[model samples]
Structure formats: C-alpha cells, structure tokens
Target: MNLTRTWIALIALSAGSTALAASGLTGRAFALAVLALAWVKAELILRRYLHLARVPAIARGFSLGLAIFLMLAAGLALIPA
Candidate 1:
C-alpha cells in the first residue's frame, strides 16, 4: 500500500500486459487479456496510491474509451491487404 509497492505494481502490470500482447494473441482475446491486466493495475492504484475507493465514473469511462480505441486500431492494422 505504500508508494514503493504502488510503483512496483505499475511496472509489473506494464510488463505483464506487454508480454501478453506480444505472445501472438489477437482479437477479443487479446483485448480482454489487456483489460484484465489494466484492472489489476487500477485496483492497486485505487486502493494503495489514490486511497480512493470511489473513483469518478468519468475516469472509468475514459479508460474504457482508450481500451476500445487501442483494440480498434490494432484490428484495423491487422486487416489483409
């Protein structure tokens, strides 16, 4: 719950998410994997660093929007020529 632990959680989340994305996963599978990782990270931040049990709905909405954009962009890039 300390700052040090929060930083470590963030790093671990980044590594785990990136590894999953690089492991030949695709489509909704990949998106869900990344979203799951993000949730893990968010939980840590909200509980430890933010100490904010009640995050604003706008923050969650923005996070969801970003995730959707990333998934859409990746899907488009993977389209056949």
Candidate 2:
C-alpha cells in the first residue's frame, strides 16, 4: 500500500473513532465499538506502516495481543461498578 494512502487511512480511522466516542455513546456498546475500531486502526498500522504482512507470525502475534488487551479492557469496563 502507498504510504500516503496508508497515512490518510490512519488519520481517517482515527477521526472516525473520535467522532464515534464524541457522539456520547455509553456503556459496553461504546467500549466494544471503540475497541473494534481501534483494532482496525492497529491492523492498518501493523500491516501497512510496519510491513508486518511480510512476517505473518509477528502480525498474528501483534493482533492477538491487541485483541486480548481490548477484550480485557471491555470486560473490566462492563463489569458492575
């Protein structure tokens, strides 16, 4: 992917995620949505920017790590106060 396009996508994704959050979404819905969007952004960065696609193992490792972290965060946020 072109570096310029990748950067543009990253910026767009970031803006969209922020807009989603600013829309006043609350609770688990918001956390899940944001986490999902963040995952997309991370994948984009890892694959396009970091060229992790060349190393499938590393890519999967990074993605799995991110997924686990996000799931934990969501779980904690969704738990009763």
Candidate 3:
C-alpha cells in the first residue's frame, strides 16, 4: 500500500481502538481486540514506514516474532491475576 493509504489505515485503526477503549468494555476479548489492532498497526509501520516489505525474509521474521509476542501477551492477559 502507498504511504498515504497506510497512514489513513493507521489513523482509522487508532480511532477504532480509542472508541473501543472508551466504550467501557473489559475482558479478554476486549484485550485481544485491542492487541489485534495494535498488531496490524505495527505491521503497517514495519512494512510501509520502515520499508521492511522490500526484504521478504526479514519481514516474515519480524512478523513471526511479533505474532509470537502478541500471542504470549494475549495468553497472559487471559490469565487471572
């Protein structure tokens, strides 16, 4: 995607996340939703802004690392404190 489109997408995702946060929701589902948005935003930044998309291998590696970290985070969030 072009930079402009990426920027717009990031803005939209941020707005969505903000709206969700303001909705007074609480739970694993909410956390996962927010984290999912975060993951997409992070991918956009990495691929478009950082130009990681040019290197397929590196991009995949970064994406995999991010997915693993987020999954672990989601799991931890689901656990009772």
Candidate 4:
C-alpha cells in the first residue's frame, strides 16, 4: 500500500477502535474484538511504520509472538466478572 493509504488506514483503525470502546460492548465479545483490533494496529505499525516487512522472517516471528500474547491477554480479560 502507498504510504498515504497506510496512514489513512491507521487513522481509520484508531477511530474505529475508539468507537468500539465507546459503544459499551461488554463481556467476551468485546474483549475479543478489542484484542483483534490491537493485533491489527500492531501489525500496521510493525509493517508500515517500522518497515519490518523488509525482513520477512523477523516479521513473521514478531507477528507470531504478538498474536500469542494478545490472545492470552484477551482470554484473561474475558474471564468472569
């Protein structure tokens, strides 16, 4: 994607996440959606902003780690009241 497009996407994602937060979603659904958003945002940063895409191997490794960490975090957040 073009740099301009990437920036636009980042802005849009940030706004979308903010809207999701303000929508008052609760429980597991909310936790999962928010965590997924976090992953997307992190991926965008790592790829476009950090230029990690230049090294496919490192990018894959980092993405795997980020995914695992976020999934665990989301799971913990969704645990009962």
* Most lDDT-accurate candidate: 3
Ranking by TM-score: 3, 4, 2, 1
Q: Residue 17 in model 4: shift from native, Å?
A: 0.9
Model 2: residues >4 Å from true position, as ranges? none
lDDT agreement with native, every candidate: 0.72, 0.88, 0.96, 0.89
Residue pairs with colliding backbones in model 4 are none
Cα lDDT of model 3 by residue, 1-81, tens digit: 899999999999999999999999889889999999999999999999999999999999999999999999999989996
lDDT of 1 by residue, 37-72 (tens): 776776666556765545667557655666686667
Q: Report the Cα lDDT for residue 55, model 1.
A: 62
Clashes by residue pair, model 2: none
User: Lowest lDDT 10-mer window, candidate 3?
Assistant: 23-32
**Candidate 1 local lDDT, residue 66:** 60
State which candidate, 1 or 4, has the greater TM-score: 4
Model 4 has an lDDT value of 0.89
Candidate 3 whole-model C-alpha lDDT, 0 to 1: 0.96
**Model 3 Cα shift for residue 19 (angstroms):** 0.5
| Deviation in Å, model 2, residue 57 alpha carbon | 1.2
lDDT of 2: 0.88
